[model samples]
Target: MMWLAVGAGAALGAWLRWGLSVWLNPVSSWLPLGTWLANLGGGYLMGLAMGAVLAHPHWSAETRLFIMTGFLGGLTTFSTFSSEVLTHLLKGNWVAATGMILLHVCGSVMLTLLGFWQAQQWWGRA
Candidate 1:
């Protein structure tokens, strides 16, 4: 059952990643919108899930395993982020490369905090 959950979550994550890539392709030239969005969204969800699970001690370990290890691990594309940054640098787009790194790192962190706070407000109240 645990393995099944992991497999399902990973598959879902992969599909979501692919779908986002495809959907964002037309706007790929829009200064790293897709990757930034993906990273921020993933980070936020990760923070929310982590906070929710930790706050709820009764939540099953399988839930954490599936979300953190399977879904988030599969969904967050560090390699792609790195590649995109490198591509920008290699293409002599130093501004874009720097912006991408800073935006991804800082934006992800901020969004994650926002997610945790929202989750706290929502689940903590419950």
Candidate 2:
């Protein structure tokens, strides 16, 4: 049952990720905007989901797994990010590679915190 839930979530997440790439990747050639947005958004969504799960402990583990491990695992394209970084390095564009790394890492951390805090505020009052 857990596996099924995760698989279903992953399928949907993967499709969504692909759509983001198709739609937004063309906007920039130097950096994959779609993948970047995916990571940032995934981080925020992850934090929100975790916050909700923590606030409502009665929820099943499957629900958490489906959202975080399954959906997020597929939505955030770390592999694609790595490849893009490698591509930059191979082309001797160290600045671009490092910039991308910093942006994704910092942005992810910040957005995750923001999302978690926002979710907490939404549920903490109760």
Candidate 3:
């Protein structure tokens, strides 16, 4: 059952990632905005889910696995991020590479913190 849940969550996450990429592909020809959005969104969701899970200890291990492992594992694309950065570096676009690195790392962390804070507020936690 746990495996089933994880598989289902992974499938859903992968579909969502693909849909977002297809939707954003035409909008930006040079940049990988789709991957950025997916990673940031996945990070935010992971943070939110983690907050809720921490507050509510009754959440099953399977639930955590399905979310943190299955869903986020499929949604976030670290390899693609690395590849994009490497491409920029190889092309001598130091500024772009640094910018992307800072943006992805800092933006994702900030969004995750925001999600965690929102979850805490929703749960009436200080």
Candidate 4:
């Protein structure tokens, strides 16, 4: 049952990730804007989920696994992000590579915190 839940969540996540990429990634752009956005958004969502789960301890571990491990695991593409950074390095675009690395790391964490804090506020009142 757990496996089925995870698999289903992963399938949905992958489709959503693909759709966002197709919708946002422009052919002419050098940077992968779609992937960046996906990761950042995923971070925020994961943080929100974390906050919610913490507030509502009644949520099962399987439920958390389905959303975080299964869904977010598929939604956020760190492997692709690494490959893009590697490609940039190989092409001698050190500045771009560095910037992307910093932005993805820092921006994602900040957004995640923002989402967590916002959700925490709602949970606090509840």
Candidate 5:
């Protein structure tokens, strides 16, 4: 069951990543918008789900496994992030490459924290 859940989640995540990449391919200019958006959104959603689960003690281990290990692990693409950064550097866009790295790292972290805080507040009142 766990393996099945993981497999399903991974497939879904890969599909989502591909879809987003295709959608953002056209407007890709200086920054790699697709990867940035994916990481930030994934981080936020993961934080929100984690916060909800932590706030609500009724959540099961299976739920955590599904969301954290399955969905989130599948959704976030650090490998792609690294590759994109390296591509930018290889293409001699050092400034843009550095900005991308900093923006994604800092923005994702901040957004994730914000999501967690928001979820905590929202779930705490429940």
Candidate 6:
């Protein structure tokens, strides 16, 4: 059942990631905006799920696996992000490549923190 949970969550996450990429990627020429966005969003969601788990320790392990390992595993696009950076570097777009690496890393971290904080607040935790 754990495998099923992960597979189902992954399928949904992958579809969502694909939809986001198709919808937003073409609007930018600097880098893969969709990939970056997915990473950041997935980070936030992972944080939120983690915070929820922390607040409610009684929750089942499978729920955590589904949201954290399964959903986030599929949603985050580290490979795509890396590939986009490499493409930029190959094309001599150093600034864009650097900017993307910095932005995605920093942005995902910030959003994760924000999501955790928000979840904590929602759960009435100090």
| Residue-level lDDT tens digits of model 3 in 1-126 | 899778878888888888888888568644688888998999899889878987888989898889988888789878888998899899998988898898788888898898898889887563
Runs in model 4 lying further than 4 Å from the true structure = none
Off by over 4 Å in 3: none
Give, for candidate 6, the lowest lDDT window spanning 10 residues: 117-126
lDDT of each: 0.80, 0.88, 0.84, 0.85, 0.80, 0.88
Off by over 4 Å in 6: none
User: Across residues 8-107, which tens digit of lDDT does each residue of candidate 1 receive?
Assistant: 8888877787777777846867355666677888899988987798679788878887887778777777888899889888889999889888888998
Candidate 2 Cα misplacement greater than 4 A, ranges: none
Error of 4 at 32 (Å): 0.8
Error of 1 at 119 (Å): 1.3
What RMSD does each model have against the real structure? 2.0, 1.4, 1.7, 1.8, 1.8, 1.2
What residue pairs are clashing in model 5?
A: none
Better of 2 and 5 by lDDT: 2
60 Cα displacement, candidate 5 (Å): 2.2
* lDDT score, candidate 2: 0.88
Error of 5 at 31 (Å): 1.8
- After superposing candidate 5, which stretches have Cα over 4 Å from the reference? none
Models 1 onward score TM values of 0.88, 0.95, 0.89, 0.92, 0.90, 0.95
Residue clash pairs of candidate 2: none
